[model samples]
Structure formats: C-alpha cells, structure tokens
Target chain A: MSKVSFSEEASVEVVTESFADTPDPRLKHILTSLVEHLHAFVKDIEPTEAEWEQAIGFLTATGHLCDDTRQEFVLLSDVLGVSMLVDAINNRKSVAATDTTVLGPFHMVESPPRDLGANISLDGNGEPCVFAGQVRSSDGTPLAGARVDVWQANGAGYYDVQQPDVQPERNLRGLFETDERGRFWLRTVVPRYYPIPDDGPVGRLLTATKRHPNRPAHIHVIAEAPGHASLTTHVFVEGSPYLDSDTVFGVKESLIRPVTNVDDPARAEHYGIANPFRLIEFDIILDPVRP
Target chain B: MSKVSFSEEASVEVVTESFADTPDPRLKHILTSLVEHLHAFVKDIEPTEAEWEQAIGFLTATGHLCDDTRQEFVLLSDVLGVSMLVDAINNRKSVAATDTTVLGPFHMVESPPRDLGANISLDGNGEPCVFAGQVRSSDGTPLAGARVDVWQANGAGYYDVQQPDVQPERNLRGLFETDERGRFWLRTVVPRYYPIPDDGPVGRLLTATKRHPNRPAHIHVIAEAPGHASLTTHVFVEGSPYLDSDTVFGVKESLIRPVTNVDDPARAEHYGIANPFRLIEFDIILDPVRP
Candidate 1:
C-alpha cells in the first residue's frame, strides 16, 4: 500500500472539504462543522482500535434497542444533555414566558382528551393529587381555550407503556382545555421520580459513567393557543431526589412546583379529591407569537 | 412552576459534573470531552426541532439497516470520513512500516490459503493480473513466511459476499505466505472501482451532501510476521477514478500501485496466464515490534 501520510490536521481538512458542495447551505455548514468537531474528538481521545470497535458496537446496540415503542437515540441525546442544549438554544425565553425543556420520548403517544377536573389515573393507585393551573399570556391575561397535554409516570415510577398489563391504557395521561377563566384542573396520582429505561445501550452508558439514570418526578405539559408560541416543558415536584441531577437534565428551578398537603374538606370536595390529598398548582405562561 | 433559567453554558457544566465520578478515569475524560463537543456541535448548528428529529430518525434507520451481515453505522463513519480518521490516528506510522487504511466491513470471511501463484479469481471474468510483492523489514531484510491475507471485488466491482447467488464462494480472496526469500505472487483479476453499499441511511447522507460514494479500486491486505507489528492496509490501483476523492478517504498516494499492461506472450505462459495481462508490484514494509 502507498503511504499517503495523513496527519491529524490533514484529515480534518479533507473531511471538511468534502462537504463543500452540499446543496443545502445550512446542511453544508452543519456537516462541515460536525466533521471538524468529530475529528477533533478522535484526535483528543486517540482511541485504540479496540476502543473504536467497542464504540461501534455500542452504537449498533443503541440502534437495535429502538422499536416502534422506544427511541434509544433520543434517550442517548437526553442523557448526554445534547437534547437540553438544543432545546435551550432553540427556545430562548424572553423572561416573560415560561422556560422550556425536553419533550421526552414518552410524549410519542397523544394524550386522550378529557374534561377539566377529570381523573387521569384510571387505575386508582398512589396518593391522590389535584393538579390545578391557569394558562396565561406573558402579560398576565388569561388565555381561554388553550390546550394543555399532560402525562406522567404512575406512583410506582412506571408509565402505561412500561407496564401495559398492570397499568390501564392512558393511565396518568390526559388532554385538557382552559375554561372561560383559563383555569384547568385534573385528578391524578403524584408522580414519583423514575429511572429512565437503562437496560439498553444508553442505560449501559449511564452505568458506565457512574451516573444515576433517575429523572426528577415531573409531569410533562405542552400548552398551545392561537396567537401564542407553544410551550413544551415539565413541572417538577419540589424536593424530588434527582431534581438537582436529573439524568436527562430536564429540570429547571422555575419548573419546580411544591406539592402541598390539603386538609380542607371543602376544597377537597370542590376539586373532587379526598381530604389530606396532595395539591400542586402550576401556572402556564405562554409568549405571544412575534408579529 | 418555578422558573429556573438555563443558559447553554450551564447545560454543559451540569452534564460534565454528572460524569465526575465515573470509575474509569479514561471513560470519564472521554465522556466529558464528548459532551463538550456534542453540545458545541448542537449550539453551532442550532438545528430546528424537526432537523434534530430527522437526525434521530436517520440514526435509528442506520441501525435498523444493520444485521449480522451489514454494518450501516460503520458505513456512516466511513462516508463521514470518521473511519479513516480513526484509522489514521491509531496507525501513525513512524516512516518504517506500511500505511494503514480502513478494514472495511467486507473482510468478514476468512481468506482461503493457497500456494504462490494460485489464481484467486475463479470465475475467470475480468482482465487477468499478476500481483507480486515482497515482504521485508524496514531495515531491508526479507521477512520469510510472513502471512499475507488479500481480498478484492471481482471484475464487475462486486464482492462474493455482495452477490452470493451470482459469485462463487470466496471467489476473490486468498491467504498466502512468503517463501524463504520473502516473495509472494498470485494470479487474480484486476479489481475495478465500486460504489459503496449506499442504499441505506449513509448513502442517503452522501446524496444529500452531493458527495459520491465510490471507493477507488483496491485490494485489502493484512500482512503479519513474528517480531514485527502487523499491517492492515490497501493496495489502491493507480489512476482509479475516485483515487483523489475516495468516499471513505482511505486512499493514500503511497498505496497506489501503477498497473503495467504486459503484452509479452512468453511472460504470460511462464506465469500460466493469458498473453495480455496486467501486473502490479506492492512491496510490504513491516515495522519491527518494539522491545
């Protein structure tokens, strides 16, 4: 074989040059930058052949782990914090609107529509919690008819998809709308912090990195209204164990809502929940669409 | 929900800190650097959510495309010039050994051992060629009995594995050993340049990038002997169309051997071949094993 004599510098140059003719300028720029960074990573690591092979095998396993029901790559991105970084870059809130986070892989299923104050936890498990919130614009004006889609793990820290036999379909998931006053409430069990699926490659990566796979207990919410930019975020339970180190980096200090123990029988009856149940109030603020 | 403002800088810090306790220091360093580069890549691209999703889908599809026989991820690496970069970084020759290139996915099957001058091209399909080479140490001493494993695509630019039904099993692959003088020769058809298996996600990426997926015609070789470091490389055919722009960037000027068209009938008869034949001489130089 001939010796082409490739230095680390030359390798990067060749790769970036290859993408010069990419028809899409944005794609070309992205690809060129990607080559530069990726090559830099290789040079920095200087991985042996065995290590490179191991990486290939790990990536292959990650891909195989995904099916119609699971998305391992997204989980990979989330665990590595790339997903949150992208989200942060793309959704720069202007201080008036609520901050956004990852739309975790679980949002694949569309929430089942229900009336306000509906019980989403159909299995009747875990401590009853009444979640009440109002949808408002950044200006403090209530946004009537805003759609709110919510989903959360059961008290056992498992979603309906994870325990199809034990959990009923659509358990702890619902789609609700703001009333004339932009107030909406739902009856459900308090969500517990849960481990992200870790039996696969991403899970292996977490374990290998000495990092816990648990996410802070949180309820995903996607609120959208005409004339407002849609908001996709999570309302984390205050004091959750993994809040400070949520495996997916989805937690935001502003997104944390304290759960209060409600002893008032009148309020419990009004919200159609048992006395001594937990109550969490989270208000959603959406930014108006740019004119 | 409380408002926890997250800047791009904070996201990287959180991720790097999460891996601080990784038991393996190398892994910890690799993960940290990976996070830094990956997050930087996302920030540089600022890809739309749809673009991000598209990338995830492409990666998932690449994985799905791999089975026991195919490796789409490796192909992805190759087309992105990552595979070559890894090869280049890991195999930094000190001017005493043959240059290394990618051990492409097709080297799965073991080469059948044969005597010197044995014909590897069983179908007798393309222009016959005599591949002769000498294995020597960097100090110019003959390295007798060095094992040379060689494989190449047939005349139609397809490997036996690629067309199992059409090509005979192991049609163009052989394992040979140098004689006492460290010389080995073989009778085989001259290989033609071929496009990579680009029907998968990687191929789609190449198309989108306006890059060709054709590799220069080359014979894969692995030469090993006692007291010397093993060599994994390719003997590229000079003047091959994609020599200057190998889709995988595996081509090296030193590895390109000019093919000589010999019309001498006497020489063909001596080598037990047709009158008109091509010839290429690629001398292997092995680096001595470090004490």
Candidate 2:
C-alpha cells in the first residue's frame, strides 16, 4: 500500500523498519548503537546550522586532502593521544622489559642492512657516540643474531622521510644483527628532538586545542628474534624538553636514559672515536609470544 | 664513549639512558605498551613503502575532514564497521525495544518546532500519509508531553540539507510534543531510498572496496521525555529497495513497517485528509537513565 501523492514528513518507525535485510548482524548491531550515540551527542551539543555546515565542509576537505604521502588523520589521532590510548590497551608489556613508544608516522620504508659494529649516521656533523646493547629474553638469556632495526632524526630533529630530497633516502635508518653474545654495538649522532609535521589539519587541530606537537629527542628501535614478542621501543634523552608532553604520548620512563660523556682512551680506541665521547647503554628484553 | 659515525648503510646502537625522569606512571605504562603493539602491527602488516605512505595520507585526510557538522572520519569508521563495534560493546540493548543504527551526519542542527498535527513537508508533490506514534516508558507506561523530533528525504530522495537552494530551510523536519495521552501525529510523504554523499575519501574507500553507497529509504525520529533516556531511531518502509545494503549500516527490524492506505472517512475527517489516505503507527519506549 504505497501512497506517493501528498507532501508531509514521513514516519520514522516506517523508515527504520524498511531496512531489515541488511546482512552482517555485527554491522546491524554496530550501526544501531552508533545512530543512538551519535544522535545523542548531537542533541547534547546542539550546534547551530552554520556550525553544522562548517563541520561537513571540514570533512569534505579532509577527504580531498588525502593522497599517497600524507596521513593527516592518523597524525591527528597521534597528536590527540587516541593512538597512544589504543596502543596502551593493546600492548600491556610485562615488567623488566624496556617500555615502548609511538612508532611515529615516518617509519614507512625498509631500513638498510648493516653489521653489528657499523655506524648508521651518514652525516658526520653531529656529536659521535657508541651505543651498545644486549637483546635478551625476559629471563636474561641473551639471544644471538637478533635483528635490531633502528632509526632516528638528525641533530635538527628531521628524518629522511621528512626531507627526502635533502637527506639521502634511509639516512640514519638501518637493520643490523646482534653479535654471538646477544650484544650489538654501533656509533651514531645524538639525535635531536623534533616536532611532528605541523602542515596539515592535524596542525590546525593542535593549534586549536592549544597542545604542542613536539616529541622528545629519542632513537626508535625494534628488536626481534624468532618466538619472542618483538619489542618496539625508544631511548629518550634524559633532559629532553618534551619528554613530559610527547604529542603522540610516546615517551615512557623506562625508555629514557642519559648519555654519559666518557674520556676513557681505551674505550675510545676500541670504538675508533676520539677521547671524550658520549656513551649510553640500552638493554632490551623481550617476552616470548606464543608461536 | 660515543664512537660510532655511521655511514648511510651502516647500523649503529645509540645508547639511550633516556626516560629517566618521565613522570606520570600511567603515561609511561601506556606509551611503552603502545610502542610495542604498534610496531608489531606494522611489522605484521609489512605494507610496501607506497602503501604505507598512502595509509598515512588517508589518515591525514580523515583528520582534515573533521569539523563541527560533518565527521568524515566517523563515517569512515562507520563504513569500516569500527563505529558499530564500539556502539555494540557500549550499548547492549535488550530484545524488547527497537534496535539502534548509525546516526547519519545530516542531523547537525536542531529541528524546527511544529504542532502535533502539522505537516513537515514543504513540497506538495510527494507521497501523502499520516504518521501516528505513542511515547512510553520502557515498561510501557505512557509518557505524557513527550517530544518527538522527525525528518526525512523528499520525493527525489534528497534531504533538505542536501538541497538547501531548492528545499526550504527545515523542510521535511519537525519537532512535535506528544499530547496528554502520550500520542503524536503528523502528515507527510514517504521518502525514497538514496545514496550517501560519495564524493570524498570515504567514498573513495568504498569504491576501492567495491561497496555501494546507497542507504535504504527511511525517516529519522528521536523521542525524548524528562527522566527517561532519549531514543533516537528510524522507520524503514517495508519493501523499499536498498534495505539490505545501507551504506551507513543503520537498520533495525523493529523499525520497519508498511504504511497502508485506508479509505475510512472518519479517520480522514479527523486528520483532514482525503477519503483515501495512508497511515502508519509506532510506539516508542525509552528506558530511564540513572542520575
């Protein structure tokens, strides 16, 4: 009995009922709840008509802005701390292992391979230091030949991804294997802390929310061995200004460490650096994930 | 000592005694766990460099798309089924009441007020029908003076918001208060099913995923009374096409009903309609929210 001739607002009950055949019970359940909450949220907020149009326009632009290189939305999530929240609820690392942080939006490519003793810094201008670390199981047994992937921003806190033309592709990024004793050592510059890209809608959100976009100075590392839960972590500089307020909420106390300057001639000779250089040790422990 | 000056291809261990002074134990715990899972997910996904960049760009655009009225990202979440999942986990409705669905982005502004028996249609060329509904507590107690806000698409399957220049402001939308007997009535046309806006990144995602953007034809309704939880729901026409494939995933069986034509002169006299007219009824029951 279809009546298609008069003009008036139709009934909601009839309209809602007509879509009974949608597949996916999960989808149905989710959509129904979303409608309820979203409607409630709108009623609660009660924005003006103009404001509503502005929101729509903003979303339209957001869709238009997407492309192969930019991910403004994820950055927004990172800056707003939602990403961190999701990660926190999911990771739940055991005690004793070093904590982890945000992988950031820049780790988009494969790192170059290198030997255990090799240096990853292509630019020689920054301060030199030797970083030695052991990859061990949660019970302190070292795992030899563990693969360690590392990347960092330059002294100015810019990654190669951020400056593809200026910085050589994969600069300061490398993949290396651990030594027989489950130890790895390499030389690199002290990375400078940097702010996230502030050139998109996420930047606008940051400005609107009065939140900073800087992450503390840190080096990102991912350690892995077969059967072990891969550890994605960072080593934060002890005094970095943004440590307490990493825009992505990535900084953790267990991941922060101080870089000690050592003038020991023997240690300097062993690593082939001049006397009085920076030294820091980062030990990583990984739990066994069910195979 | 800092002894490593790595070349572009060399790998180095950067000692990090960082994160020594980070406060906020909760923050530290969260950041650490997030780092672990995020890195793991990335490694697991193993997206190509180009794919990774594209994802980043998609997220960036999603962020840019947010504003006051439209939430493209939320829509994205809806299409991806994340929004519904969140809704289901949070809103575990019982079997008696009408189910929920995704609240579309169009409900941005407050609806215009109308008398209980007033028509909300500005266009007189569409379907003619009378909609009657009752409001009650979840236990079926009548709720006198309850409010019912309603809106719908026009004969062309377009909302007033979608055709501002053609449709009068607030066309097909109305807010009505229930009578002393907790009953409300209105006159209007049955709206046809239509497609969601498909000119954005979310549209692109749908296209790439080979999904249609069509939503089942339906009317939107929200009923509220003091001391009772507000109910936002929709009414689907029984036989409307696209009921099985609403792009926004908003369909509940309890919401579907047929509007049958009636030739009773007495009812036509009461509603001031012609002898042959259409009618549909829906009784909404809302639970009480604890203070």
Candidate 3:
C-alpha cells in the first residue's frame, strides 16, 4: 500500500472537507464552524484518551439525566451560562423594550388562565404579595388583550412540578390577559431564592466546579401580542441572595423590581388583599415586529 | 431595587467567578477554559432559542442511545474527529515508533491467548490471509515476550460482538507473545471496510453533515511491554475505498499495509492455508518510557 500519511492538522482539513456537500447552507456554515471550534478545543486541551472517555461519560450521564419533566442539558447550558449568552446575542433589545432572560426548564407546563387580580397562590402559603404590570408596545401604546403567562416557585422555592405531591396542581401559575389599559394584576407570594434541581449530572458538575446552584427569586413571564415580537423574561426580586450570582446568569438590571410594603388598608382592600402586603410593579414592553 | 445589569461580557465573568473555590488547580484551569470556549461558541453562532432546543434534544437522544454494548458518546467524538485529534495530541510518536490511531469502540471484547501462527478466523469464511509482525523498541532492539493483542472484523465487516449468533466467540481476536526473535504471526481473514453503527444519533449527525460513515478495513493492535510506552494502532488495508476518507479521521499513511497475493503453493502449505492467499506484514515499534 502506498503511504498516505496525515498529520494532526491534515486530519482536521479532511473532516472539514467531508462536509462540503451539506445540502443546507446554514447547516453547512454551522457544521464547518463547529468542526473548527471543536477541533480547536481538542488541540487546546490535549486530553488523554482516559480524559476524553471521561468527557464522553459525563455527557452521556447528562443526557440520561434528562426526561419529560427534567432537562439536564439545558441545566448544563444554564450553569455554564451558555443559555444566557445565546439569549443576549439573539435577543438584542431595543432601548425602550424589556430585556430578555432564560426561559428556564420549568416552563413546560401550560399556565392556567385566570381573571385579573386572581390569586395564583392557591394554597396561600407564602408572604402576601400583589403583582401588577402593564403590557405596551415600544411606542408606549397599550397592547390591550396581550397574553401574559406567569409562573414562579412558592416561598419554599419549589415549583409545582418539583413537588407535585405537596403543591396543588398549577400552584403559583397563571395566564392573564391585559385589560383595556394594557394592565394586568395578580396576587401571589414573594418567591424565595431556590437551588436548581441538583442530584443529577448537572448537580454533580456544580459540585465538581465548586459552584452553588441557586437561581435568584424570580417570576417567569412570556407575554405576546399580535404585531409585536413575543417577550420571555424574568422579574427578579431585588435584595435576593444570589442576585449577583445567579447560577444561570439570567439577571438583568431592567428585569429587577423592588418589593414595596403596602401598609394602607383601603388600598389593600381595593386589590382584595390584606393590609401591609408586599407590592411589586413590573411592566412588560414589547418591540414591534420588524418588517 | 438597584439595577444589576449584565452584558454579554459581564456574564462570562460571572460564570467564571462562580468556580472560584474549585479545589484542584488543574480542574480550575480546565473549567475556566471550557467556559470561555463554550461561551465563545454560543456567541459565534447566536443560535435562536429553537436552534438551541434542537441541540439539547439531539444531545439527549444521543445519550439515550448508549448502552452496555454500544457507546454513542464515543461514536459522537469519533465522527467529529475529536477522538483522533485527542489521540494525536497525547500520543506524539518518536521518530522511529509506529504512529498511533484511535482505539475504536469495538475493542470491548478481550482477545483470547493463542500460540504464534494460530488461525483466528475460525469460521472458515472469506479470503484467507496470513498476518505476521515484529515487536521492537524505537532503537530497533527486539522486544521478547511482548504481548500483542490483536482484533479485527470478519470479511463481512461485522465484529463478533455485532453478530453474536453467527460468529464464534473470540473469532478474529487473539493475544500473541513475541518470540525470542521478537516475531509474532497469525492467520485470519482479510477485514472488509465497514460502516460504523449509524442507526443512532451519531449516524444522523453524519447524514446531516453530508458525510459517509464507512471506516477503512483495518486490524487493531495493542502492543505492551514493561519498559516501554504501550502502543495502540491499526494496520489499515491499502487501496480500501475509504482509505482517504475514514469517517473517524483514523487513517495515517504509515499505518497502511499492502495485502499481497501469495501465489506460491509451498508457502500456502507452510502456513496451512489455501493457494493464492493474502499476506500482510506489519510491525510494532514502541517508545521508551520517559524518565
């Protein structure tokens, strides 16, 4: 056999050339860049076969840890901050619009529709708080009838999905529509900072890296209306521990809302909640769809 | 609430800082580099949320496809040329030692010990071939009693593990010891080029990239001795269709060996094979252990 020697550099070239015929141009571009970056990483690491095998095992375990209710890969991306980085790059916000955040793994459950001012906290376990918000276009026009889907963990920092047996179905989850003034309101409890689902491969990774797995207390919102780009964002609580160190890096200054103490009885009665409740005013501003 | 805004660059810093307490310095370095590279990849791609979700799903399916007999992660690394690159970076060859290649996924079955010149092709199928080899140090000194573990697929391009019902146990696999002259020989069938296990996600990746999945015909060998670094490599068939385009980027010119047709009846009789058998001569050279 004639010698057909290939150096390490040559092998990379061969692999890149092999993808020249990819049918889709976007796929071709992505695959080409992926091959280059992947090979570059391998070269930089110079991992032994044993080390390489360990990576394979880690990734496989990460995959196995995912199911219908849990997504370890997304968590992996979250902890690595890849999810937030992608969000930042793809969802560049207009100066007047709300900033975007991670649509965390727990958003799979469809939120139950509720009337304005409905209390999503069915069990009434956490500290009383009222959330009022407005949905508007970038130009300040009210986006009446816009759909605002919301969900959050209870005071103990457990989503209904995480504690299905303990929490009532759809606890702290509601879908409300904006009224004539593009305003919406709901009664719920102040969300507590909580650790992400650990005990899986992602948890193991956190432990290995000496990093905590807590995300700051926040309510997830996905608001949408016709003729506007949909918005998926989190309204993080100010002063929550981990606010500066969110494991998923989902915090944005524009997304933080202060929890104010509302001591007036009449004002509380007007919203049908007790006096001295915690009040948070958050507003969603959506960008018009590009032509 | 005070604003705690994070830009794309700031998020990377936050993620990197989360690993501040990593106990192992090497792990800290690896984790830091990984985070940087991963974040860079995401920023470069700017994949939309849907594209990101598709990646998560693809990885999940890849992990689910792994089992005891099959390893989809390793296959994924192989198809991406990562395995070979890792092999190359860590196994730089001495000027005189044999070039190393991938220890493919199929080396799971242990080779049964056999005397020199034993026939490993017990099934009595395919074109007969005689394989002879020498084990030596890079300085050309004979390595007596060196263990040479050898294995290959059948002429049908299926490993015994891939076809347990048909192929006899231990067929096409043997462990031979080098004699005083540092020579070892075995009789087996010529291995045919075969497609990798592509019914899984890795295969789907290959299809999406517009690449073929065939590996060139080759015999795997792992030669080990107490005083030298172990060598794991392949003796690929020259003129194989996939020689220039092995899916795993495992081919190297120095590893290819011509299969010569030996028409001499006497030689065939000497080796206890039929006339016009195939003969391949391969040798193993190991590097001295570094002090």
Better of 2 and 3 by DockQ: 3
Greater-DockQ candidate between 1 and 2: 1
RMSD (Cα, Å) of model 2: 10.9
- Best model per DockQ: 3
DockQ of 1: 0.57
Model 3 clash count equals: 1
Residue-wise lDDT of candidate 1 within B1-291, one digit each (tens)? 232335687777778888888999999989888988888888888999999999999989988998988999889888877888888877777696888899999999999999988999988777889998999999999999999999999989999998988999999999999999999889998899999998989888899988998998999999999999889999999887888788888887879898998899987886677878889889999998889
Off by over 4 Å in 1: A1-6, B1-6, B263-270, B274-276
Candidate 2: stretches off by over 4 Å: A1-63, B1-192, B197-291
Interface RMS deviation of candidate 3 = 2.7
Considering only chain B, what TM-score does candidate 3 achieve?
0.95
User: Whose TM-score is greatest here?
Assistant: 3
lDDT tens digits, residue span A163-264, model 3: 888999999999999999999998999999999989988898789877888999999999999999988899999889988778888888778898999899
lDDT of 2: 0.68
What local lDDT does model 1 show for residue A232? 93
What stretches of model 3 exceed 4 Å from their correct place?
A1-6, B1-5, B263-270, B274-276
